[model samples]
Target: MSEMEVLVEVRGTLGRLTLNRPRALNSLTAEMVRVLDRTLSRWERDPEIACVLVDGAGERGLCAGGDIRAIYDAALVGDPAPKHFWRDEYRLNTRIKRCTKPFVALMDGIVMGGGVGVSAHGSVRVVTERTRIAMPEVGIGFVPDVGGTYLLSRAPGELGTHAALTAGQLDAGDAIRCGLADHFVLSDALGTLVEDLGSASADDVDTLVRRYAQEPPPSVLDTERGWIDECYGADDVAEIVRRLQAAGVESARKAAETISAKSPTAVKVTLRALRNARGLSSLEDCLEQEYRTSCALLSSPDLVEGIRAQVVDKDRDPQWKPALLDEVGPDIVEKFFAPGDDELGLSTVRECDD
Candidate 1:
């Protein structure tokens, strides 16, 4: 029989979840998301389950992100599957954040996009030196979703802004610095940690993780924050790029070049979303906003082209419509945040009860 995409196991008081698609870097399929949500919900309600531990099978990474190829195909055929997948996925993220049981995420390797949504929201987020995290949606003509803006908006200074626009990877220390992860457990020790977790009570999970944890190596992102904060602080994407170019730092100038290559519309929308997320009181609100943005991008030419170039075509040369940042007018950006009929109604306010 084919292996399950997500492996669920109950070991004593610890419920274990593993993303099982190793070859695909454990990219989440819609079914996987549904399974994770359902499994987590079941575990949450189980009185005997004191803690839930999530990890990924195989050596490469926990999860790269959601199945982009699936998203690409859905976007091509105008399928409504992505919308439904995201709705459930975002709800799962919210559930992780609010989980009554000790929700522990072993963020051991490549965690990005939907992966971040799953792990970063957990109560006890553990990372290793092998960890590489990112929210790289802009590169594919997409805004960061799955409550990404909420987490990124809360990152210290504009490091989050830099990450959003540049689609850069964050190392273990950087992930911790950005508030995406909590503890640093060495890669070799993760097995022992898992064994420890299997026997450890819910109340002792935090202490057990700390016992295995060590101080992360210093984050280069933190040292570069002076320039990153200065460059990305501007509200406008174009202005941010201009600042990066003018900063006289090679890294800053490189960041400018990187941002220049991403979808102009996506970049602008990402900036606006991150800024808007800063004001939101809860992750649910940010998810609602992201749903609007994700839905809006369904019709975007850049979405298809970006995916084609980056994934399908592997050409790395996307012909983005409205190619330049200036060409992506405020109207184009505004539509991404506009109220939608099929809103993922997780937030309570709903601008005053319909």
Candidate 2:
């Protein structure tokens, strides 16, 4: 009954949560996240709700990301409230990751940043040919948050590191190969699937997912795998950049250039976060670390500068602090991972199998 930007509807025993901001490609808002968190929590305890389906309202599909415009406004005013946005958003992310009942995310198209946060952790992730997934946070001087650290850290070989730093977009096939999505179906089939899921019991839902699912093909970026692994397998961001520059492969060079253009401080901290996250046992642990890093990022010069160039100035030219990657020392990167006394530890949830 509360005013909502996101809509939650219960159809029989199935609860459907739709991201309703189509004009912005369903960009997530703090209010939307709060509504979803409350609704999901209700469904978790309600005996009538057998399962939940998350999808976006528009033809473009699920979501683009968090309302960066809001974050940008806060950054301009030097307001620290944006950190609270991440705190609540991350809580919702972890809740979805650990939901007891089956949660299916219909990832139809243009799923990125916050979109990845909402869908990637679900018990069932369905992708279509229309799906275009990425974590482009680096472009705006931020690391991938919203539980991305947990998912990306677990990716095969060095794919996670490569994707994290490059902010590359992955098509449906690539998404499946990277273990970002669980099932592949045509975009048009999603409606039918949702209808089937709504009337189906737990056993029936499993059968439907399996029946409609098709094996994902080789990724379009498959040829770049060797280069990605060799270059990104380094011990730190600096070395990774060096290796990429040395490789001379077009993909590697392009990736290096992309990193070079970003906030050097963000690159250093993001790489270190991904590397440190590799040892964390669960998504919750990774989210907690990401939350701390994100809060610290709000105060950093790079975040504001990056946003200014890319979003405000529209100049596509950012004067990053610590302009060179080497200037962002290891000590600076390490500070983001240091425990914050006020930070909430990630929930101890059941581990997800990739």
Candidate 3:
């Protein structure tokens, strides 16, 4: 009914997309998701479209996240928009991953939550020194969706779990080292890089990107890999906390504190989802599992309470129902993953023989 929030254009052989809501830090709306998903699908089959390049309109970032205020409002009023939005968005994530074209994502700023959805599945993700990437759904009483479980589950060591628990931002180097991003380019050089890629033939896109990619500084994630793996790779949330507390390093202490303050259900479910994701065969399957868990959590009181405290009231204090990890039993965790009639209907998985 309204204009699309995303702008699609063609420059030479590149199918270009700019997120148009800079005033809102390019935070995604349901309309934005629909438009982006459809555009990528269309461009995938066009012979004239060599690749798709996506970036944000503003300087602040590519995308902050989905417009959670909408979900927060609907949750408060018992509306179903959040449910429908997540369903469509998850399917779109799958489409981006499976698309035939080379999809380049400019993740130069605050890439988190739903923003991660649109770009993490790209064929090539470019991060700059300013890249501040994370999957911070736990803060809002949700686990990572939009194929996040798949991405995090595959990250080097336990870096993914640490990010999930802490909602910490990763730099360009860290994003590359941790596998969130594939290349690092200097912030000032992005425009020229975009031009080169835009004008290159489809076959030359990779070469053009390599020509512009700069060597990233060393990654703290790589340096701290041992600590992250030792702490987050433990049995469960409680075990991870206990280990971090026992370690007594300032970093470990801070990590423990962050996990301690997050929603208990979100923490435990996130842990389970990450572990489950490690064993899944495909991104589509991980998304299916995430869809089930998301729908279940959306129906829970804690999500609404968390949104009310964080986004609506600005209280910074959510009275979570199962306030402790121990209180959230396996039954509660399993309930979120249980089969249901409203299961997200993703398209059939496309496979290629090796």
Q: Best by TM-score, which number?
A: 1
In terms of TM-score, which candidate is stronger, 1 or 3? Answer: 1
* Per-residue lDDT of candidate 1, residues 66-161 (tens digit): 888888899888899888888888888888888888999999889999999999999999999999999999999999998899999999999898
Clashing pairs in 1: none
Per-residue lDDT for 1-354 in model 2, tens only?
A: 235568889888799999988888988887888888889988998988889999998798799999887888898788877887887788888889888889999999899999999999998899988889999888888899998878888888888888889898888888887888989888877878888887878656767888888877678666578988999988777788889999989878888888888788887888888888898887888888998899888878878877788778889988888788878787888888787776855554352221
lDDT-based ranking, best first? 1, 3, 2
> What TM value does model 2 have?
0.94
Superposed model 3: Cα runs more than 4 Å off: 1-4, 347-354
* Cα lDDT computed for each candidate against the true fold: 0.90, 0.84, 0.86
Write the candidate numbers in order of decreasing TM-score: 1, 3, 2
Worst 10 residues of 1 by lDDT: 345-354
Q: Count the backbone clashes (under 3 Å) in each candidate.
A: 0, 0, 0
lDDT of 3 by residue, 1-354 (tens): 245468888988889998989888898888888888788877887998998999998889999888888987887777889888987788778888887888899998788888898898988898988999998888889888889999988998899999888888888888888787888888888898887777777778777888889898889878887778899888589999999999868899999999989989999999999999999998888988998998888878888887788888999999988889899999889898898998675635463111
lDDT (Cα) of model 1: 0.90
Q: Candidate 2 at residue 286, lDDT?
A: 86
